[model samples]
Target: MHSRSLLSPLARAALLLALLLATAPAMAWGRLGHRLVAQLAWDGMTPAARAAALDLLQDEPDPSLAGVANWADELRANDPGLGRRSASWHYVNLAEDGCHYDVARDCPRGNCVVAAIEAQAAILADPARPREDRVKALKFVVHFVGDVHQPLHAGFAHDKGGNTVQVNLDGRGSNLHALWDSGLLEQAGRDEAQWLEHLRGLPLRQGAGLGPSDWAEASCRIVRSPGFYPGRAKIDEEYGLQWSATASRQLRLGGEHLARVLNGALGG
Candidate 1:
């Protein structure tokens, strides 16, 4: 009886995919990338850390440590209330005024990936907090750690972390941010486990005790580095060949550092 056009489930899903491809810029490390990072962290966790994490996840829909890696993102999609409130925690908008990362100017009111990670880490480390609270914090920590490591997530204000900057990948319409999110990784032609194994084989260059803010800045540095942001909007085989290596490195670092942070927080 309504005039509004209702799309079929498949059609609606296609529309959602398109919109998410455009708007899900802050889902740093993409679905596969986040899974890979969490899996590595789970694998590397000490017995005590694993026990602590498992204890908190007793009631989780996906109780396995890595299985709940996308808990925050899934929550964002399904729970509108908490989803809207926590959206900004995914990424910090670094103003284009040079390469400085002043917490006040870059990350105001503690609504950013770096600040969120630090806050959640503190919460998870606090044994006095309720189990539920710590479990939620653990999810955010797992996600935000991956977010800060995505070079485009720590993006400039001008282009909304390259979301506004249009580009092409393998002759398809896309944006700079989305390309790095899943486009680059999808081309790897391997499943998440294969990707994880490949990344684990790489040497991780962990900074000497870097914090969340430092991790964001590291991603920013990579963004500023040469051969990342294509001079032109359209990209092809050459660009992919060059930047896939950097993408791999970023994923590796994300997984490595996530393990370190969780290990430290859980007293591993």
Candidate 2:
């Protein structure tokens, strides 16, 4: 019933292509989301974890948790070679096999986000690592923890983590990936103070009951939910509202999980 029905095959295909994007889903949480997680982690860090982390952060421009929130993405420009080398570490593609994650098949070579979290935690935990190296490791561990909790970051591989699913989120022309990355958070209209308050209000965890694959599976389930697609580009404000809780929950989870990771590795 759409205009595409009247166009030639090539024209229809091209028209559809024009509306899609194939980029890696923008880093989860964009800048704001990551900062929220960092602040939460910092607020709850043990004295030992705080000391070890800040020691590595000696010369950072902004010597606070939120300060380095976007460091991993910034490295894409600040240190292009290393950034390229670690590009795949930000997300793991979950597709074809349904909600279950098969580590060997889905995360071969230890390149996926779950592995990135483990690897960076190791570097942060190892006292012998150079201070600068530990700093970089700390940044990625913080960033990837945020990444794994972004629903689309762990979404279907077929759609490039929903990057290919074109949509309009609350009057903004954007895709599903962009919507989750920050659009919904932005739409919430909360300031950093409010977000931090919300984060603190969430129940503290013992880091039990969930891990990277569980986190990934949780996101995959959200992306594949019947209510999520909403005719793609036709998804509007009401649809976006339905999932605001999900965004909040994921952001809170990111903050909580990151706190545990940092404390476990550096808390001493």
Candidate 3:
């Protein structure tokens, strides 16, 4: 029998909830979006930052930033222990707090993406830390930056970042969270390079003056916008046309933010 079968009913339920929380927000941008973010960050990074990043990642299975861009999401299968510990690092719940991040209320004990990015950036910047540890931190920073830009990732927590909101896409069953994660991008029918080209053409209006918390607040604001949430449950082509641009903008912003973070941490 499975080891979980040995637990009492209450214990089983608690375990299930924990598992759910861990996996729920982790699906921020699908692999394609994540890779695109990594590539964009790479393109924007300074020479010193790129060299440092490559040095830290030298011993990893895939040594490039884009190569490890989705590492955090694959942690459940590749490294279960770290996956459970860092799951909450993917998102913050600020919907109830006026889209503002109050550390004591929304991020108890530094568990959300905003704090996670700050913490990982610190580790990556600390030359005294072990090379292996800093490498992992770099991966987390790349991923969490992308996660924080997903509008629904910082949306109302009652809906668990819209994971609980059911919707239909071309008659297929799906959820709001899933739609933002990859649906809109996939509907564009572009490959990774094509998507990157499309994203690059959009004018980036966000500045480097903002930090992680500010980014989360911006995402939350997007969620609170009128018509941001579809009036109907059907995700038609019109719906995709209206929202995919928003998703693209977020991807562009996420990439720029990551580049700046890495430049600060790794660039001399």
Candidate 4:
């Protein structure tokens, strides 16, 4: 008969190490829900827009495309079922909450991403700047444009925009911020391309009906929704039934608006 004590200490250590290795990628990239936006930026835009997007993306000190790509590749290699959309939730939350200069307080009214976008506009508007520099400026604008659309990126003063609100997602213990970051998007079971296609099909209006301030306000409106966490005690059940759909719709709308603004900004 096999005994529990039959395994050596080295064998146990090896098993533990292997398990950790298996789970590490999920822990890293699974939580980084913003990969979809980056992927879309890289794939969906025009060549000039893509270049501009890359320039804008450089504002984030970490979480670069290469870093996310490596993390994603590792996760996919380990688990073929892991989809790129899995990262959108984390990305939205990170953009909203993590972009803040102060974790203890609300994000500054004009944050880094906002500032970067405005700066890019200035560069793009400059007549004397070279085409190369203008392209670089446009890249930053494209990236930051996507960033601001993430509702969580425009977070609230309280709970660090849901980061401090702990809850369980589908019985998996997580935080409110985390739920918004990846939980709902993962539940959708669709890839980024599919999601983007859906977003593109949404009813979109034209001619400056929305702008940067409007984007910020829209996110804040969602973040401040009265029913956001109805019945605080039953957060998990409530989120499953109500908040998840809200988050999904918000993400879809955000992506659609992001594409619209980029197309307009680039004079497309």
lDDT tens digits, residue span 27-90, model 1: 6667888888888778778999999898888888778757777877887668878888888888
Steric clash count of candidate 4: 15
What would the TM-score be for candidate 3 when compared with the true structure?
0.88
Q: What's the candidate order when arranged by decreasing TM-score?
A: 3, 1, 2, 4
Each model's Cα RMSD: 8.6, 8.4, 10.8, 12.6
lDDT of 4: 0.47
Best by lDDT: 3
lDDT of 4 at 67: 32
How does model 1 score by TM-score?
0.87
Selected candidate, larger lDDT, 2 vs 3: 3
- Per-residue lDDT of candidate 3, residues 162-216 (tens digit): 8888776444556778767876666565668878878888777787689999999
lDDT of 1: 0.76
Candidate 1 residues lying further than 4 Å off, grouped into runs, are 1-26, 169-171
Give the TM-score (vs. native) of candidate 4.
0.55
For candidate 4, lDDT tens digit of each residue in 28-137? 11333345544444444466654544554465445344233333334336555643422232222222443333322322433344455555667765647887666555
In order, the Cα lDDT scores of the candidates are 0.76, 0.76, 0.82, 0.47
Q: Write the per-residue lDDT of candidate 2 for residues 4-115, one digit (tens) a residue.
A: 1344544433333333232234778888899998888787688999998888887899987789989998878899999998998888877557878888988899988988
